[model samples]
Target: MLLIVGAGFAGLSAALRARHLGVAVTVVAGRERAFDAPECLSLEGVRALHDCGLDARQLQLPPVREYISRWGESPMLSRAPPPGIPKNIMLGRVQLLRALRACATEEGVTFVEADELYRVLPTRQGLQLQFTGPVQELVLDASFAIDASGRAAVLARKLGVGRRTFDHLVAYGVRGPVHGLPEGVVHTFSVADGWVFAVSDSPGQAHVCFYTNGRLAGRVTEAKIMERVPYQIRSLMSDEDMWLASGVSAANASTSLLDVPGGTYWLACGDALQTVDPLSSSGITTALQQGAAAVSAAVASLSGNLEPMRAYWLESRAHFDSYVRNRNSFYGFGESAS
Candidate 1:
């Protein structure tokens, strides 16, 4: 049996892969719904899946167009329009969650709803996962465990995995309809503090976020984050915009860093393993890919093929670590003094 914690993209992918290998897989999703950072599932994301032979049609996701941005400039520019791409289709986090859930159900994998995992203990027999709420304190026996619980590092912390802070990056974001907004453009700008982005073709909303420096963390609180959203666009949003009601200004509240520590029965994926600056806009893509990769490793281990775990670790680190180093260098940020 294979046990997976957190049924986000990585967890969902792992569960599917394990079932394909004839391994019994059970997933405990933290929330009933998957929460994708708004606009993280743009056309570029769908295109990646389509290009990999996973039919975006199968998941019923919308088409993502070009990207746009505005800083010192006026209107933003659209990306080079690509052919054969799906038109203006974008799936909300909820829809994506639904699709993955349906896939798992159809494949006969067990999914427990509203399941929040507090800790994972390694016993003589597989892993013992403790849950909060209505779920029982069940101990699952499996050859390996995949931790896809996002940045919380639930398993990483329990297993003593060490994390490293790369650079200081902060972002405040909200979602809403952008009146007269240009479609197909992901606009980015470098500010004195950090940067901001405006992306279109979102799930009925345009997403905007400002990334700032850690030095001003105190001023970037939830009550102040919205102040960072430009006034020229504030009127275009409605009162019901996501994250708008949460607070006026919200600090990014994330430690800008990467975690590369290894464990005997645990592996990390997505932001749980490493968090790069949002400038890359590849967080969701990398998460989906890492989830799939982690599943591959677990399946291999179950089939008496243990080498896949090593390969999975090395490959995942190479991509994320390279991105971190390159971003720091491009922005003239100094390497960690450590």
Candidate 2:
């Protein structure tokens, strides 16, 4: 049996994939609520969901038709999907999580909710996990364990794996009702300090955020956020709209091949493995892809083949490096243009 931790896209995807392969899999989702900004599903992400038997349209996700981007003080530029490419979709983060949970349940994945992972013990055969909260004192064992715990890198940290964080990148944002943004369009505006991305998930409701250095984000006030955004977006902000703010380091990379793959009965996937820049808009896609790969690695490990795990680690690292290079190029272009 495989034990997958965390039930966001990565965990759910891994569970479903393992079950599809006839492996007994259980998911421990450590949180009850999924609180996040709206997510934009790239074309690859949409295809991945469909392959997993999930229909975003049936889930009532809003279609995103174009992107309007402005670098620094430059004029805004509009970009539509290229010919023959699939248009992206946008949906509230929590809504998407709920839909994914429902899909996983329908596919016979067992879910255990816990507030914390108290301990993890390595066994001769596999690993034992202890959970807290309603599952207090309960211990579960599995042939293989997967960590999909996002940027917290829950299992990785517990295993004493060092994390390399991109200190230069940080993001702060709020979600609330806003006006002036056209429905189905995502807007990104770069500023001297950082960049702002806003997308309307539903009529009159949008998630707006700023990506900047961690220090700058820490010092940024609500007033400063308003000033950084485009005038059209700034005009829409008002005291009446309740806004919630949160911040995090947006780019994190790990040498997973060196640090993760050689485990006898453990693997790490999704944001626990690496985090992408929001400007890349590939978080969900990366999570889903790695989740599926992790399952394959687990299955191969069960059969006494360690090559798959090594391969997956290498692939994940390469993907992360490529993303970092591209991110630097993108930010560099914005800087040079400014």
Candidate 3:
């Protein structure tokens, strides 16, 4: 049996994939994760869901029709996918998890309701998991445990694993009533000092967020973060009012990674393993891919394959390196809108 420590995109993905691989999986619903963040599922992400046997249309996802982007004095550009690249879609984090959880239940994946993990005791055969929720105390043992609890890294932290923080990047966001942008349109633009990303969250609603070093969030303002954006862009999104909404919030957008992603009997996947900038616009996809990748290595090793876990780690690192190069090149225009 295998235990996964989250119910977010990655944990749920791992659970679904485990079932597909004929492995029994139990998901620990550790402290609830906030699912209000806005996300855009890339073409790659759509395929990942397809590989997991999920249908986004049935999940009520809005397919993106176009993307408008501009950066650092560059001309405003409306670009189309090249060749076979499929279109990306705007995704609601909450809606995605709800769909994943529904599928997991239908597939008979056992879910242990718990507030957070209490204690982890190591035994000869495997790991003993403990948790105390508002309802009761519970314990379970598994041959392996996965920390897919997103940024919390619950199980990893309990295992005494350490993480390395490379920077304090964060996204300050606002979601509420707004009008003007057509449904299924995703927009991003870089100003003289920063960048702004906006999506039509739903009918009569919009979500806007900006990335910057967390150390400077206190002095952030609409003008500094959204300056010099063309009227063409401004006409599409009237973001000036979002700043006054008490609904304003902040989410960690830091670029960090675990010092050690796994051990002989456990591993961390998704954000618990590595977190990239939201500017990449592929957070959900990365989590889903990591979950499946981690489990693939686990299954191969279980079948007497040679050190597949190490091989998986190397592949993961290489992916991160590639992501960094792309992100740096895009950000080369200027520092974050902070």
Tell me the number of clashing residue pairs for each predicted model.
21, 0, 1
Task: Determine which window of 10 residues in candidate 3 has minimal summed lDDT.
Answer: 74-83
Clashing pairs in 3: 194-337
Candidate 3 regions off by >4 Å?
31-33, 73-86, 218-243, 303-306, 333-338
| Model 1, runs deviating above 4 Å | 41-54, 57-62, 70-91, 114-119, 183-185, 202-205, 220-225, 228-261, 334-338
Give the alpha carbon lDDT tens digit for every residue of 73-123 in model 2. Answer: 532222321244335577777887788888889889998877777788899
- Candidate 2 whole-model C-alpha lDDT, 0 to 1: 0.72
Order the candidates by TM-score, highest first: 3, 2, 1
lDDT of 1 by residue, 58-165 (tens): 764434455443444212112222233233344556666667767778889997654556666777756777676565654456567787877776777777676776
C-alpha positional error of residue 221 in candidate 1 after TM-score superposition, expressed in Å: 4.8
| Candidate lDDT values, in order | 0.62, 0.72, 0.74
TM-score of each: 0.78, 0.86, 0.86
* Tens-digit lDDT string for candidate 3 (233-300): 35655565554444556678888888888876788899999898776767789899888878877777
Residue 168 displacement in candidate 2 (angstroms): 4.7
